[model samples]
Target: MNETYDKRIMKQKTHRLLEAIAALIISAIIALIFSFLVSVLSSSQVYAQRVAGREGLYRDSVYRRVIGQGSTSLSCYLSYPQGGSSVLRGYGHNAYELGKLGEFIRAALSDTLIYVRSVRVCGYCSVDGNYTSNEQLARKRSLGFMQFILSEYPFLRRYGIRADWVGEDWDQLRSLVASSTLNERDEILQIIDRVDIFSGREKLLMDLNGGAPYRMMEQLFFPLLRRVELTVEYDLHRIIEERYRRKLNDREFALLLEQEREKVRREERLLAEQRALKEKWQADSLAVEETARAQQARAQQAGAQESARRADEAAAAAYRRRREAAREASAARTEHRKLYPLWGVKTNLYALAGLTPQGERTTFMPNLEIEYFAFGRWSLSASALYAYWDFAQGEFWGVTSYTLEPRFWFSPTGLCRGLYTGLYARTGDFDIRRSVVEGVPTDNRTGTYYEAGASLGYVLPLSRHWYLEAGVSGGYRRVADKVYDVEQDKHYLVRNQSQSRLRLTDIRLNIGYRLGKKTIK
Candidate 1:
């Protein structure tokens, strides 16, 4: 019972204390309102009269503000550190460029002719992280950057300021990869074109070629991606007409310091505003000049980056050319090792010189030819045909021949095989008795012959050691024939006939062999 009574007593005391505090607050509020009304009423008449004249001064100030205008743009880029949402002001031109943006914006706000409409920042993040986290990071980065701007210029903390965001900028990555001369650019693009969103694409990149390509991209391109763009848009005040233009005089300027009528005071105020606008214009010019300098610097940096990229591309192209040249050189060496012969010997298999004895019937004639390939495309050869065989009495017929030829091959390694042309000179001695002319047995004819001709032939390689060659020679052939009447006498020369003709000298189908190694040139 005593505790309940004590609680009721404390509650009543608490209510009385609350009533007293409320009454004090109401009294202070009424007193403040009464003082505000008294001051406003007392100054209302003079304030209205001064404001009426000040409207014209305001128009004049606006005109001064509009004249000699300069640039009013504030565009800049801000970058963030790798994988972090916070901005790095000192990072990669962010400090200098963002400084220019702030200077222009702060100056624009104070200028009379410009009204800042919006301050916008667009944020982007690289694809190094997950999509959801990157999206949130983009928003946070943009908001954080705007907050930094606002904190720097607290007057900009007004209503209607916003920031937009773009997360995991894959399109930017694709464009960078396309324009870059990366060694694995194709593989990177393939994964980007074919991989799924928020899937194992990043994983594949993390594991590609021991992560070398991914690391390269991260080092070179991702820094550009982790950035934000700031744009400050504004509207300009209209140009005040000529009639509103007037200069402030010395009297008016002096009257600005002394007590005078409202008109003189208004002129003084107008002069002050005009001076303010002129100063603001000067400040704006400086900002514009500074911004232009920054832009020129940025352009130089971009040019340097472009030069570096092109240098890398040229290096890659040179490397590829060297690789191709190396392969071609290896092939050339292998083919050079196949050059087989320096000295060669061959026997003509066809019975050409043996069975095809000219102007006489020879018993047998076998020929041997030896060649020394001086160069792969050139050779010198000597040939001899000496066969003297008699099977019956009083039927002795034989031919002896010697030939020297210098050959030119159609190919670089034609010593072992291919087509060739040669100029040959030959001298031979022969004696024969049985002859046939136009399908009828005629008188015996014997001859000593001299020949000079060009020969063409193709050599087909049967092995590294052996080849099959076929050729025929045609040129001037001279045969000194000792003519004898067949019915008259066996060993009697009836008459001497001089024989000179342009005809086939010899035909050869040779089985040839190559020996010894050639010195490589």
Candidate 2:
């Protein structure tokens, strides 16, 4: 019977070993398949990137420029009222010219085989002030022009539109000086060429010939400088590479171009409707402004009459006020005899059930606070709190802390009943144990830490003396502790002591009682 039992036990052990070997073999096969898939995906990604790079190169090389320097470029000039973005009504013809330019851009964008890359709007300002002010003025003019364009043709926003400022254009000034019939043309040229800074140039011109050159430039070249210049960059679209173009027939390419043109026409119609709406809105806005101005004038006249009436009434009230003031002085003297306490003490119940570093564990804390109201709507406070924690399962033992806080309350009249904020300083000692394997205590040591933080909270009165409060505090804690390392299922002391910076976060809730005056209101 003993031999039979031994044979059965040996058979069971052999079967268990075979099952373990089978699982290992299956795991190896799955790992090899996963590695193969990763390598294939990496290769494909590299190849796709290379192909995209090549395609970009081909597009740049084969595409032709359509609407830049040598080709057709359009220009429209609009004048603005002095120091304003509104178009000058006397130069209303410029608006019509701008409308024509918009039509041309719309037509170009409608073309299926053309790609509009960008539109550049360069703004220039007159030499009316220092370089900084002029630069800002130029940018405003440029932005004003761009706004007008987008308002007129809302569809053009899709194209890259850039606004640039050339504050007091020196190049344009130089050109004007060269071509003008002024007597001081040579002197102006010499001044422009000699000075590199804008302020120096302005000063030189003002000093030259008793400021004659400056006045002439302001009248002639300055007006021209306060303008916006527009430039559009576009290119012909290339759908396929040069080598692949032979594969597509002419009819297919034409169909593609025709489809693109249809889309452009639809967008243009939508933009035209938007432009009409914008014009109607502007007309209504002008009418509203005119009405407001008339009403404002009438209000001013009424205000003057009302002021005179108030002056007459105020004279009569002054005589009566003197008689009333004497009576109130006697009453106030009797009320001033009552005395109120200016100090208060409170304690928080919620600090006892606070959370600890180990999520499931909680610490018991007791806190006390004292406050003094020194002036109107201002008070100062000081508080102290103590905490203790122990968690055998989490390897923590005998952790304790003490904190001191100083606070300032903004509403002294509503002390312990309104809003309060404060700062705190904390120091603590802890003894904890950790394991190489989870749930197994392998190392134990004690440490000390210190932290400082700020807190904000609101106090709501439950009764005349009791209050409920909630707040959050955060700061940095520096810890001095022993370090342990776990390897080969064994624990080793790496360092007897080490320092680490830790971030501390705490949420607080309080149920406290106040001793002193009740809420004022």
CA-only RMSD, every prediction: 50.2, 26.7
Q: In terms of lDDT, which candidate is strongest? A: 1
Model 2 spans with C-alpha error above 4 angstroms: 1-75, 86-94, 103-113, 181-183, 236-521
- Displacement of residue 193 (Cα, Å) in model 1 is 67
- Least accurate 10 contiguous residues by lDDT in model 1: 45-54
Alpha-carbon lDDT, every model: 0.64, 0.57
TM-score of 1: 0.33
- Expressed as tens digits, the lDDT of each residue in 280-388 for candidate 1 is 5456545555554555566578877665555455545555655555555455434433445788877776643445624434454456689998676888989876554
Worst 10 residues of 2 by lDDT: 47-56
Per-structure clash totals for the candidates: 0, 0
Model 1 stretches with alpha carbons more than 4 Å out: 1-337, 357-363, 391-396, 414-416, 435-442, 485-490, 518-521
Report the Cα lDDT for residue 449, model 2.
Answer: 80
